[model samples]
Target chain A: MSLILARIDDRLIHGQVTVGWSRILQPDQIVLCNDTIAADPWQSKIYKSAVPPDIDVSILNKESAAVFLNNLPLECKTILLVENPEDMFDLVRRGVKIDEVNAGGMHHSNSKYEMFEYVYVNRTDIAYLRRILNSGIPVNAQSVPGVKIHTIDKLALDAIESIMP
Target chain B: MINGLVVTHGELGVELVSVVEMIMGPVSGLTGRSNSGKSVSELADEIKELISSDNDCDTILFIDDFGGSCANAAQLAGAAGSSTRILTGVNLAMLLDFVTWRETMPIDELPRRLVEKGRQAITSMGPVQEG
Candidate 1:
């Protein structure tokens, strides 16, 4: 119930999340919705150890996260972190209220459509984001708070070809 | 005057603050040191004094490591004193954001803002490089 901020940063957990995000978000719970990290004890331990002792970090997969998020206390500020658009789409399809997603850093990839210099989007990803935005969730292209904002769906997608080879 | 304290091991705490000062002007009344010599309980007691003295409704003590001595001290002090937030594993981006944002927003928003800033700072640029 306390899903304050949900981010889709490929980097599930790192210095930014443990040190930077933890400091800023001040969330009592840091929920990472990545299946791989959840199964691997070594990886989970490493991520948990990285976080400060004060905050609780849980690594859950997309399925379990749905159940967990339902039971989470309303008072606790929970941050849901995902790796890519696929995972986010999966969650969205499952009825997760992900309003206003900040495309932090998707990085450069040879995808079907080139949205921008750094972001290359495919048809499915583009459609998904367009739907999410049309639903009234403000999807902005802001890496940091200080950086310039780039409207995701509003970007000129006419020039972006659907060819991926 | 808002007071900030950085607590860490060896020179990590001081080094962090020095980096902050270099970029974002001078932060006055900021104190930091290694919490090695004293016991955990003793160190916590000392940190309490630091926070209480400068803790006039607004004070943040940045701890270098969460599981480390400095963070433990700040957490303990939080119970004794009022309005003292402890941020562990202090980093340049986080310190800058906290110090910069706290000036405008209310203290209540400090934690949320910190988390947002922290999320953006993380990067999966590549596999970790070993020197």
Candidate 2:
């Protein structure tokens, strides 16, 4: 498929994606799908600046990203980045085909609990992730390339059981 | 006086600061941090908090490498037009140069000097001169 790597990381266009994953994936284009960032020119500028000038960079909202990914050229290798699981769910719901989802970073907050070193999730995040999982797409948590990939199913199940009455 | 914060992947930052301090004696305004357990945003927030804690002095963030998580977090922390400066590819010579000239040099010009010093520190001995 043209869409090679689809990932969920809060810090989009950062080192892990740019240096770590990009070097391995070697995608021709990196597309960031986020509504808030796409809407803000200044924010878009900052994110775009982090990427190298050689590779193509596009920042589009969910709807536009869905359309773009649907029609992407077969030869164009692309890395799809979304900030959160909600965005991934929305993209999947909007008919953006993805082979697998890499869960990179979901930093800690009061509302979230640590699932892995780089992954923190709350009930809402778990629910959305479950929805994505149920759609037959595998979600794996791996911070950088060449690291061990952990499936989110067991962790999500444990988390869901803990939160339920 | 300008303060420096060394941020790296694991214990590299901490060890670099310690070695520099060992060579040049104790330094008061320099610290090291690790990105072992923290995520990018968490690391960025920690950097922001550190910068805000000592608001009087201009801070310089020494990152292990460019296009790494430490550098990325440093960029995020410094993106809002703060008085902080980020220098990637940090080395012992750069830290030494910073400690030596921080009090004398202006913050704006210090990064360029450190970059030069860091680059100059790397050299080959040309296959060991004949005795």
Candidate 3:
């Protein structure tokens, strides 16, 4: 597949993606899709610097990312990254064919409830995640390679039921 | 004073800080962080918090290995820019040079100096020929 992995991590490009997943998937390129970060030159530079020089890095907004993913060469093994479920949903809606989605890291905040040790979500996040799961994409949370992958569907369902008004 | 933070796997960061302090005599604003049981985001958050705590001082993150978790976390912290710098392949000599010259040396120049010191400390140490 052109797209080897699609991950939703608030910290888009980091050790987990660069070292953990890269070692396992060994993708030819990493594509980071975020409007804000793509616009900021400094943030783009920081993300690019995190990855080794051997692999290609693309920092593109959602629309550009959709075009890039659609026409990606079959030989190109690309790992797609978005900061949140909303962005992931947007990409899916934009016709980016993804087999599975990895909810890598959301982190804890006052507004977010813990789904896993590393994954956190709130009502709005759950809503976006539900939409993504409803679209028939499997979402799993695994912080690093060689760890148990927690299916996020059940957790999202449970979280949705708990926070119901 | 420019702050220094050493990040590594296991107890290396903590031990490095302790050893440096033992030699330098209780230097302030220099600390260490470990990536044990912590995700990249968690470690990045900690680094960001430490940097934010000392907003006035320019902070330098010394990572034990390049392309490792510590270096990745430092990059994710988004603290690499004008005020904050991330230096990989950290060693005792670099930390020592950092502690010695941080107060007086310009922040931009200190990274190069520390790297030079670290590189200079490594040698073949082979038996010398009798002269």
Clashes (backbone N, CA, C under 3 Å), per candidate, total 11, 0, 0
Write one digit per residue (lDDT tens) for candidate 2, span B1-131: 99999999999999998876544445788999999999999999999999889889998999999999998998888732447899999998898779878998988889889999999878863432222
DockQ for the candidates, in order: 0.04, 0.03, 0.03
Q: Locate the minimum summed-lDDT window of 10 residues in model 2 chain A.
A: A156-165
A best-first ranking of the candidates according to their TM-score comes to: 2, 3, 1
* Deviating ranges (above 4 Å) for candidate 3: A154-156, A160-165, B1-10, B13-131
Q: What C-alpha lDDT, on a 0 to 100 scale, does residue B51 get in candidate 1?
A: 66
TM-score of chain A of each: 0.79, 0.95, 0.95
How well does candidate 3 reproduce the true complex, by DockQ?
0.03
lDDT computed for candidate 3: 0.86
**Docking category of candidate 3:** incorrect
Q: Write the per-residue lDDT of candidate 2 for residues A31-79, one digit (tens) a residue.
A: 9999998998878877887787778999999999999999999999999
Is 1 or 3 the stronger prediction by DockQ?
A: 1
Q: How far in Å is the alpha carbon of B28 misplaced in model 2?
A: 34
Q: Over the stretch A18-136, how does candidate 3's per-residue lDDT look in tens digits?
A: 75677668899999999998998877877787787778999999999999999999999999999999999999999999999999889988877777778888777888888888899
